[model samples]
Target: MNRTAPRPSSLACDECRKKHLKCDSTTPPCTRCTNESLLCSYTPSRRGYRRRKTPWDSAKTAAAQKTPQHGGTSTSSFVLGDMDLNQSLPLKPGDTTPPAPSGSGIVPSDAAVFSAEAPTDTPQTIATNRSVELTRQEEERLVHLYYTHFHATAPILVPRKRYATQAYPAHLKAVVHFIGSHYTPAFDSNLLHDAVEVLLSPPQESTLHTTQALLLLSIAQHARAYHVNALATLSRATEMAIELQLHSRDAPVRYGGLDPLLQESVKRTWWEVYCIEGYLAAVHRQPSFRCNSVSLEALLPCEENAYRDGLEEPQSITLDQYDARFFADHSVAFSSACYRIEAIRILARVLALTAATVDGPDDIQSVDNAIVAWKLHLPDDKATAIDRCGDVDQMMLQAFAFMHTATVFLHFPRSELLLRVPTATDIECASAMVPASPTSAQHATKAIVASKELSDLAALPVNKYSPVFTCALVFGCIVQLSACSAHAHSCIVQHRDRVALMTGALKSLRRHWPVAGQALRKLNTIASGIFNPAQSKQSGTSSPTTHDSGIGMDATMGDLCWFDLFPPRNGTEDFTMFGTAHDIWPS
Candidate 1:
């Protein structure tokens, strides 16, 4: 199906802009209003207006490449000013003039932003980028997508009620647009990422909004495989949050008597920082939880329903109170974010257990026990990953996924399934081994159970999960794939189909996020080694025709899609001859 070319619009009609409807910018009533018998006005029409493009010349290239120096007047980085951000603002009724785009934006290595002729603070062309040309309808759909698909997991930003009316700062707006862009087909994800990166680089005033923007952007960066950038960006966000004292219980009152909705946003932001810090650190096998109870006394987030509706939370629980009282009171409903915080706390314990020299069984068992207790105590409503709306609760799914991942990390070493190859350093499982005990068999069974649970979680119908959940899924899948290579050929046959559950989930998720793509590529490498006996036999030879000539392969098989690990084999052929799947990494 071919899409029709969009009609030329000198300017969006006032009514169409307000309604976020695509308009032809035709004389008098536009097609939308004329068809619907609604009034239309176009006060800001500039009939002969043509958008000017900045030249990507040698001078600009040199300027953009200049490294940052302290107190130096010349730097490649410059903040896109408010005027640039205003290009994103919705057009108002009876407005005499529409906001024009800025003349500049910071350039990234892969793309150019503007020429050196554009002065600093000359608000860059925020209206459109070389690769991003979304119309009003697309923007609304993307924003809708953020709340629908991603926001429930983090649940920081409010809906368009606030955004459509408020004059949000550039960084916040940039992050929002970047997040929403993930779900939009009209834009290049890389261009959007570079644009958002530039928007956040310059020194901006330290405000709660800036802190929130940084936090969201960090998640976005990590989701797209920008690991180092994500870490640095998140560190900056953490420092800004700490500088604002958002970790203190009284920070809101101490700073200002922020309104109820804004207050909840603040609390959510602080806890999110803690959750993400613990999660990323543990995932990377680094043991650090700066926002833990030792220093911060932040409150848990309010219910998602109340927060979304702008209602005041009747009560808020602290970390200590939550541990003591949450299980005792059945009526005390906890938010997914709260459970997620607890999950990270457990993951942190797993990190500690993995780091420590485990001399006895208690070391791993204790962390394993804590995870069990957390699962048993979960409220009946959240016991499963289903919400009241009968939809897959993404945050709840992530919480469970995180819990199961901890279980895997706790037991994968002792699983003792028979793989001799060492995993990547960052992958905690089998990368290093813990001291063995007689209870190692129990740990092996536990690891298998956790991986199975992960497969079930991945089997849920959804395009994506939380970025944290995606990591958990990858880690969990690694354990499952390793199990497929068990010594017993019969067991391998049994578990091979289960592996598809995870591979298919990742295959679908990477379509929406590049983080999963990275994992898939790595996993494909590991898979090729495990499944391709012929390749393993000839250690240093040209690659085989696994891409197209495999027994069960079809032309529709996508790149990096190594889900088809086995084909149907007759009785005569050995099970090992099932063979590896097709190309996973870029050639």
Candidate 2:
């Protein structure tokens, strides 16, 4: 420190000095500033003159850099900052970048629509760089698809009524995007964001927009495999409905302030959210908002046309009486859509209690009994089994799938499962001796029979409309595949056909859901190992050795699965599937 005198810097301006470069103190702009178009300054002793360039200069510079020069030719060139850029140069045949269409609202950017994440262009990403203002026809098509394919299964919104209205709400807009995105391969999160924004905004009317929006958001998130976010969005929606007392039988159905049609819509909306929360809980193997109690004794939603016409009103039934009355109504008056909702509700309870085996056998038996009773009470003509009747609507099929899948899920791991089971159970507990006798192979055959029905459904060309198609197919395949794997030598069923059924269904679903794709890839490796163990061993295909559920299996069996239903015990201390198992659902 004592010997050093500071060296003088050659650079003059702050920009040059920052870069640690030598500077020529020219009177005009310095070479660095001139070349880079950065501001130039000199010392206090002298003034500087800087050349000004028009916006056209910047445009020309950008165009020249971006456009390829195959031949020495001049075409019309125009400034891009003010308008869409155009170049008169005749582009060669194989040009990758195309000019923006007039009024396209697209902005030039570094990010390509067909990026590495998606090598091929998709309908969603076709206008990625553009601001999308959905046309009337496009909206109609999307909404129609939703009504035709989704309404029967979901039935949250009065599509016919909502469609006829002039006043469009944000939640409706959100639903449009949600449905559209399913058919669209490359989804954009911004559309989801706009939906959330509108949903979260403070309400000004009696319309159930917020709740509907939240429900749609949850559905979109779930379909796209954003499970955690979907759960959170669902929670918010559930809370909103709770605040509105939408679940209460006594709450006024208001359109604006007091519209009965609006009331019906609200009723449907609340139940839909209830059903969604339950479905999410079942799929993820977690606790959901227990609707069995909570003083929410609202009657199930009526038919859509009935609600719209204000032609029907459901008779009020107490919580205790709900099951008997609901299940008994197999008549034309019952809303099949609502019937599906109740079925899903029952499913959610089963998953919450039996999924991780956090509860005892009594809890399992109770729910199992309920499921059995539900099946028994089901109208024989309406579809007690997969092929009982001809020409079933998509909604009824969904109900059947849910009912069957719930049965398989309830008995899983409790009875000796033969095929790929989700990794959500405590194997040590599962293996533990219990009082009830283990179900014999004949008893377990119930799952096999139900699974066959799912296989038949899988073969249907319009199987996509059934919302529970994937869940049922996945669970059913697990049963069949497990049975085949456990008794490969003794199994009479065609192993190849069963494998094909599972893999194909999963592949079809994978196009829309990444989770399905992941499951499919996993199932493929497992099937390969099972069918050709010698080849699999030689090829060195890696199968998961450890089960997430802590269930241990032999190496020879290849890979078995168990979806992680419960979070780690220490991870969530306060979690409960509502209160005690006794308080879950009414008998």
| Model 2 agreement with the true structure over 469-495: per-residue lDDT tens digits | 555666676676556544545462465
Candidate 1, residues 164-253, lDDT tens digits: the string is: 433345457656767877886765666666556545543444677777888888788778766545655676777777778898887655
Worst 10 residues of 2 by lDDT: 84-93
Q: Which stretches of candidate 1 lie over 4 Å from their true place?
A: 1-141, 254-258, 326-331, 357-360, 418-435, 528-587
Every candidate's lDDT: 0.58, 0.50
Candidate 1 residue-wise lDDT at 41: 64
Candidate 1 clashing pairs? 102-123, 102-124, 102-125, 104-124, 560-584
Superposed by TM-score, candidate 2 places the C-alpha of residue 68 at a distance from the truth, in angstroms, of 57
